[model samples]
Target chain A: MKIGVLVSEGPYTHQASDSAYNFVKAAIEKGHEIYRVFFYHDGVNNATRLTEPPRDDRNIVNRWSELSKQHNLDLVVCIAAAQRRGIMDANEAKRQGKDADNLAEGFRISGLGQLVEAGIQCDRLVTFGD
Target chain B: MFTSSENIDPDDEGGVIKKFMFVNRKAPYGTIYALEGLEVVLISAAFEQDVSLAFVDDGVYELKKGQDTKALGQKNFSPTYRALEGYDIEKLYVERESMEFRGLTEDDLLVDVQIVSAAEMADLMVEQDVVISF
Candidate 1:
């Protein structure tokens, strides 16, 4: 099955990101193809490289980055949502006159149209939220 | 649990029409969830999939009439519910228990919706291929 995951909340505050991560890992292990993981609302915060937790704790941002690296996953954060919460890539940072970009590795900021496209293209669209 | 050894039916493959249900359980304006949920529904409508909408809990407030967000300096999005039918999205289900809990009636709603029991709504959700909650 081609699965598309939509995460709508940030890590720690909500269980959405963690649930999505676990589901994605399980799906991949069961021989399913993850077409895309589209992050919206506070979920865009997951793509910010500036996030740093305790050394002993599980790094959610790094986990997502590593998962994307290992599976060549398409991780897309909503540009509109990201801009509202200050998550930007280098091009967006330059255009918006920001000091620096903090978008984590293996994630790209895109539009909500990508979410719609993912729904149509993928066999199943699963959403994780508060 | 799904297994790799299990054979997938050809009819249930790539081109199969999927039932997509957008479940709304939050109130409007207070959080960005309701508005963003609407944005997703609008985008999903263009895909021409089997789509159904459910309004439960505080989500029933999203369809209430006489919504004046101007006091809060927010956009009045209550009127947008009326335009959903134009996009070919006619299946709108509102939970009876939720409405009763909130003291809301069908007459108070801006748009027409099918009033269903909580059990009926759950059954509908179970029938869906995908359920996106907001």
Candidate 2:
């Protein structure tokens, strides 16, 4: 099934995003396609490219990037949510005149319309939230 | 969107299909999800689709009983959920595990809904042709 996942929580802060991450990996391993991963609310923090975890710990942000790289998945972070939380891509960082861009590659910044579109285009939409 | 004689299904796969599920996961007032979820349901219902909403995790607060938004400085949308039935969106489901984890029983909720197990909830998601989560 074509699936889109909403990650509104954290993988490191708690179990919600971690579970969601595992679900995405497992779904991909089972030969399902992930249409997109929509990050909203606090979920936008998952896109922060500067996240650096200990060597022994799981690098969730890197994992998200790797997931997108491996599957060529659509990783869209809500622009409204991302900007408000200071999560910016190259364009947004340039527009905001920020020193750095936190939104990693393989992810795009968009509005909720994309999420609505994912709903219409994908077969299933699952949410992982706090 | 208003209903008409002609067929219309915005959430339909190809034709004017019925039934759309919206999964909401957020506090009622803090995030825009609670309101957006209602809008989707209303709009889909106007398109003449069978609309059902599910609440999991913090989303369950969208249906907590005895809500007083005045203290939180937020508009009470709990009442809006009551109007869902008027829109023909009566199939509201609450995750049993979420309720249990949060210590919220049916009595603590704003409306009466079917309590679905984790596996059942997952199946319900898989059963939907179009599912949107917020």
Candidate 3:
């Protein structure tokens, strides 16, 4: 099955990010094709490269980055939502005249159209949020 | 950038046209869910899939007419419901119990929606391949 994931909340503050990560990892372990993982609303915070967690705690951002690197996952952050929440790639940062780019590795900024395409192309589109 | 298989016809895979239902359970203005839900619906329509909008609980209030969010300093996006038909997304189901509980009637809504019983709405949800709750 081709699975598309939609994460609507940020990490640490909510359990949504953890649940989505576990579900995506399990789905991949089961040999399912991951079409894309779309970050929307507060979920855009997951793609920031500036996160720093305690050594004892699980790093949700790093986990997603690892998954992307290992599986070649399409980690997409919604351009509109990311901009409002201040999550942008280098190109967007330059275009908008920002000081720096904080988009984490393995994640790219895109439009809501990508989410729509995921729903249409993937066999299953699962959403995790509050 | 779009993927290589972005244009693949859904039918070509297994002749399956997935039924996607956007379940609205939150009220507007207080949270971003309702407005974002509408945005997703409009975007999903471009893919030419079987999409439906279901309103239950406080979500039914999102369609109430005479909404003015000026005092709240928010944009009242209720009028966007009128544009759903333009996207060919006509299936709008509102829970009868929820509407009555909120002291609202079909006439109170700004757009056309079928008032369905809880059981009917459950059936509609069961028929969907994907249910995205907001």
Candidate 4:
């Protein structure tokens, strides 16, 4: 089955990102196709390359980026939410006249339409958040 | 103004329209969930899908009439609820128990909605292809 996941919470402060990662990984292992993983609300924080964790702690942002690389996943961070939270790609940063861009690898910024499209096109749409 | 380059016309995809329900369970102001969830609803309206908004728990407060955010310095977005009809998104359902628990009635809301029992709401939810809660 083709599935789409929505993650709406930030990392470290919430377990939503971790749970979503595990769920997506398990879904892929079980032969399910993940159409996309949309980061909305605070979930867009997961796409920031600037995130740093303690040496012994799991790096949630890198975990998502690595997972996307391994499975060729479509990791989309909502542009509106990203901008509001200061998570921007190189282009967006330049356009908005920001000093630097921090969008992590394997994740692209898009509109909420992607989330709606996932709901329409995918067999199921699952959400993880507070 | 960022848009999805892969945005496809629903008609091009064989016109497969699915039931998409947005479940609001949080208060509109205390947290950002209600407000942000509404953003998705507004965007989804452009996709021309069978969309519905369900108000449950503290979410019932979202539709309450005469909401004044002046002192709080927040934008009073309750009026946007009434504009949903312009987007062709009129299927608003308010769970009866939630409304009663909050001591609110249909007359206290800003927009017209169908008051449904918990069982009826469950039936409607079960019939949907996607149900996103906030």
CAPRI-style class, candidate 4: medium
Candidate number of the best TM-score? 4
What fraction of the real A-B contacts shows up in model 4?
Answer: 0.55
Docking class of 2: incorrect
N/CA/C clash count, model 3? 0
Report the C-alpha lDDT of model 4 over A68-124, residue by residue, as the tens digit. 999999999998889889999999999999999999999999889889889888998
How does chain A of every candidate compare to the true chain A by TM-score?
A: 0.98, 0.93, 0.98, 0.99
Could you tell me which residue pairs clash in candidate 3? none
Pairs of residues clashing in candidate 4: none
TM-scores, one per candidate: 0.87, 0.62, 0.91, 0.96
DockQ of 1: 0.25
**TM-score of chain B, candidates 1 onward in order:** 0.88, 0.85, 0.88, 0.92
Instruction: Summarize candidate 2's per-residue lDDT along B28-109 as a digit string, tens digits.
Output: 8877767655655665664555567889989888899888879877677788788778877789999999988998889998
Let me know the TM-score candidate 4 reaches against the reference structure. 0.96
**Candidate 2 per-residue lDDT over residues A23-108, each given as its tens digit:** 99999999999888988767888888888888999988888888889889888887766776898999878987999887877778
Clashes of each: 0, 1, 0, 0
Number of the top candidate by DockQ? 4
lDDT of 2 at B68: 88
Candidate 3 lDDT tens digits, B49-102: 899999999999999999999899988788889988988999999999999999
lDDT of each: 0.87, 0.77, 0.88, 0.92
